[model samples]
Target: DAGITQSPRHKVTETGTPVTLRCHQTENHRYMYWYRQDPGHGLRLIHYSYGVKDTDKGEVSDGYSVSRSKTEDFLLTLESATSSQTSVYFCAISRDEAYEQYFGPGTRLTVT
Candidate 1:
């Protein structure tokens, strides 16, 4: 797990509702990322934080937001969940600008 943990490993929600997923790491890594996995889309980056309160949007950031206030915690929020947004979300951490990233067990989200 590389000291990374995602909360609410399983979630069931209705369409148009809001959902939030959390990712915590004990490694105190400077870089944290959020990604979603779907059958055909592979993995798409949602958002990332480089340092405390320093966050940026990723390729697929629409409808999602992220925040990081501490070195060990990163939070991802879906303003309004949709069935199209149903996917397994992952959290990853890196110590530096390296290609290697350690991922947390995914959060499985379902929208009906």
Candidate 2:
């Protein structure tokens, strides 16, 4: 099983501020993903990493960027946070892209 954790479980910030969220895993999974969960949008992919230094944009990667410097850590940064970006963010890990993913507890970010 994959063990994942996110830092700063909750946060509140003003618009235009820069925010970065960290995701760490213990299982050394090869695939890591960042997603945001909202009431109506469900879970939307923000970015994903296939391996160390191998990252790619997802459907909602406009305002976000991700970097994976190591196998166990993936970081997501918001260039300029906005109210519309406020939501619950989750980190997921999977051995393969087609395999089942395990999610972290999540981080609640509120941008005012």
Candidate 3:
């Protein structure tokens, strides 16, 4: 739980469009992450933020970007969405790097 929330629980857009997803938390944890789940890929990290204004790219960050301006919010944006980028995006929060993470309900995005 950790009071995590993701906006736009479901979205559908055409290819080449821009999409932005918002993740919010009331836990005030120091670490927040974004991940995408697909049929074959399972769950893959897209990006993460360690602290306010401190973020890093993850394993599958090619088409995605993330930003954290405050401790409780993390934003993920797809500069140019594609059909291949369609997936269920999850937001996670953790108190520390090695601790367990609590995930949000997830946002399903589709690109046609």
Candidate 4:
């Protein structure tokens, strides 16, 4: 299994501000993903990266951006934070052709 961790763990910010969350992995996986968990929406994908500098939008990609400069790091950034974006964010990693994903601890973000 891959070891994954998210930074800050918790955050509180006002609307219109910029927020960036980080996800780090011990094992280098070919695929990395960012998802947000909400009360009713469940887990919705924000973005995913297959390789360094290669990324694509997911189900709920609006207001979010991602960058993968290195294999061990995947970043999720809110271009301009909004209250609607407040949710528990999770990072997941998987090997090539493997659908099983190992998720990070999760980051709780609150937008005021």
Supply every candidate's count of residue pairs whose N, Cα or C atoms clash at under 3 angstroms: 0, 0, 0, 0
Model 3, residue 100: displacement in angstroms? 0.2
The sequence of per-residue lDDT tens digits that candidate 1 reaches over residues 1-112 is 5999999999999999999999999997999999999998889999999999999999999999998988999999999999989999999999985758999999999999
Global fold similarity of model 4 (TM-score): 0.96
- Tens digits of per-residue lDDT for model 2 on 5-106? 899899999999999999999998899999999998889999999999999988999999998999999999999999999999999999999999999999
Compare candidates 1 and 2 on lDDT and give the better one. Answer: 2
Q: For each candidate, give its TM-score against the true structure.
A: 0.96, 0.97, 0.97, 0.96
| Model 3 ranges off by over 4 Å | none
Give the clashing residue pairs of candidate 4, or none: none
Error of 4 at 56 (Å): 0.4
Candidate lDDT values, in order: 0.94, 0.95, 0.95, 0.94
> Model 2, poorest ten-residue lDDT window?
1-10
Q: List the candidate numbers ranked by lDDT, top first.
A: 2, 3, 1, 4
